[model samples]
Target: MNTVTRPRILVVGAGFAGVECVRRLERKLSPDEADVTLVTPFAYQLYLPLLPQVASGVLTPQSIAVSLRRSKKYRTRIIPGGAIGVDLKSKVCVIRTITDEIINEPYDYIVLAPGSITRTFDIPGLTEHAFGMKTLAEAAYIRDHVISQLDLADASQDPAERAARLQFVVVGGGYAGTETAACLQKLTHAAVKRYPRIDPSLIKWHLIDIAPKLMPELGDKLGHSAQEILRRRGIDVSLGVSIEKAGPEEVTFTDGRVIPTRTLIWTAGVVASPLIATLGAETVRGRLAVTAEMTLPGQDGVFALGDSAAVPDKAKDDDSAICPPTAQHAMRQGKVVADNVIATLRGQALKPYVHKDLGLVVDLGGTDAVSKPLGIELRGLPAQFAARGYHWAALRTNVAKVRVATNWTLNAIAGDDFVRTGFQARKPAKLKDFEYTDAYLTPEQVRKQVEGTRALDQ
Candidate 1:
């Protein structure tokens, strides 16, 4: 009987943590030593920070999403699927392929970095009424949805319908919400110029959050500046506000204010993916409890990181302090986890994960931005430069970097081509209830329809 000698390492998800870990492992381990496999639904690592730009026509979607296959130096098999279940005791992972086929793959070592899903509350009508901005597909949908609303407003004869179509409401004032609101607002302003019949003033942008300040983690002065910038642009920056209900064409806030808008973008927050719950390990608020070394206690050869893991921040003295869920921590944790994995294989000591919080940057479209890098607060164009430069440098691929840069350059030189594809609007469901289903039946559906027609004729 022949035996496979090399220990197989399976890394789940192709986000920041999984991709960086795989990249490092490939560089550290020789092909003869161990076999590595990366499983993810998509064959790319999305640079999520710039997704708002994609929605605003400033950058193409592909530019921000880097191809995993491009890096061939890694002797890793790219498996396209999302892991649905993990039997820690049996060292097996059950994954559902893109084609909806379920396969169980046994592994010697496993790294969990499946990232997160949008955290939804039990708010009335939210699931069917509000659109989210957690993935590339969502971002693309938002771009088309916003543009189509404008197009409809221009053609509609009813004043109320036109006003409703033009009004845009963005829930949550976090980094994602702020950026989406800012960038989309700019897109509308630029596009409305082409529609001579429509007044730009008819377009209304409302940014509301339950919190008192926008991006509260960024500290006071900077957060204040951010709110001021949005207000100056005529955005209704409402604080301490919550959505009471959202319907197909209207949204009412807890403050007794009601808005009839076609667009309701939900960027409230993120929670761990449901996959994490199946691990049967200790978790902190839905995130897998991981030690400073990014390993689950008593779970041999199993490690986790990213938004799904509750990793303790060793930099803080308090035992209760856990690391903040940010791309920065996830990216750094990936490198550390890779190093620790190699150390374990070689009988070396593992290093602990510890990182200080770097300041954040909020790009509020065009030259408008708010940033605090190295404790220095900056606003306006300076902040914009920092915001763009930081994200530009963080991209994994050179091709992606250049593509994003070119897109920004082009957008600056010219204005947004705010043309609605009208493809997305034709879907039977509302934008919020949009789900990427394999059952959509594209070419296959057409073929079956034609075959049925021939049978009827015969």
Candidate 2:
């Protein structure tokens, strides 16, 4: 191995944690100190909370995609690709770039924050039929798909076909599924007016989940309030039931009822990135087990955080309790990890990750909303105001904040045009297509890649 000169720092992923880590590193580290590089499939940090709005045409894709290059403070090297594997012993990361070129990148210190993927179950035809809401492309494609359904239903002469096209099902009643159902239902409710041939009464949006309660974290009263809001909007909210089987034309629910619909959105939960498995490390329910300091236990110069790491919550005083995978926690965890990385370089003490819960927000696509900011419950416009206010403040950049604010203002005043972008037309829109489940390399493959690169070097 060549003698080390300046320390090389590499951060994986572009989600809240990875982006914030890179930003803070660039801000804190001097030019002559350490060279920082970021590896990600996209160059933007997606604001996940507002993705339902994107799919419903309330916000443009760029409005929620916070660009990493927009940083005026420091310029970190960008590798436009997704990381596949890493060899901690050799300090090398295997990456598949935009052009599919496989390159081995070496680093002195590496941060693994590759984020999570859309969690799906073993239900039949789930991947083939359901659509995801994780990425910007998926969100945009869903908008087109929903609009196309309306058009197809309007032009169909067959009664069964029209009914199938107009009926939509969204699984998982948590924040993602509930908000998605609410926003998209509102879309169809408004857009059907433009379809003079189609009867608005035929339009149906059902939100279902296996859990007994909807957003139980919001407390009973607030959860019920949110459920009432959706119910009043004509949404069929079903609980304690899930999909028994998913088919192209219909879905059989666990409650022994079959619903005919062409659209199925899956937003149940998330699992850590498949890259986590390549490390062959101990995982807590699929997430890499990490200390309170967010470091890989017993692995020097390696770190993990975000949704991919099971970081113990020091403030909670519970050993089994780990920090929940939320954007708020991820963002704060990123800064702490960055500081620790800097401290490691300076031979200083490492601090554990700890913080109080800032609460949760669920925007139901209008003045109807619910929030629990710092244990205080809110509902209706007060909750809406509190929710949006909190999100607007949490946005990392001024430009992102302005774009989001403008989109909200325009969406409210002018309303959605109900026009499809058509960019995703002729494209396969399904869960299997969007989730890169098979992208990661095996542990042996990671070792081979690094070894092969070293052989060529020698």
lDDT of 2: 0.92
lDDT of 1 by residue, 229-251 (tens): 88888899999998999988899
Please provide, for model 2 over 1-458, each residue's C-alpha lDDT reduced to its tens digit, 9 standing for 90 to 100: 88668899999999999998998898899988999999998888899999999999989999889888775665788899999999988889999998999999999999999999999989999999999988899989999999999999998989999999999999998899999999999999989989999999899999999999999989999999999999999999999999999999998899998999999999998999999999999999999999999999889999999999999988786779999899999999999999999999999999999998989999998788999999999998999999899888988889999999999999999987788888668878799998778878999999998998899999
- CA lDDT of each candidate? 0.85, 0.92
Model 2: residues with Cα > 4 Å off, grouped in runs: 1-4
Report the poorest 10 consecutive residues by lDDT, candidate 2. Answer: 66-75
For every model shown, what is its TM-score relative to the native structure? Answer: 0.93, 0.98
TM-score of 2: 0.98
Pairs of residues at least 3 apart in sequence or in different chains that clash in candidate 2: none
Per-residue error at 41 for model 1, in Å?
0.6
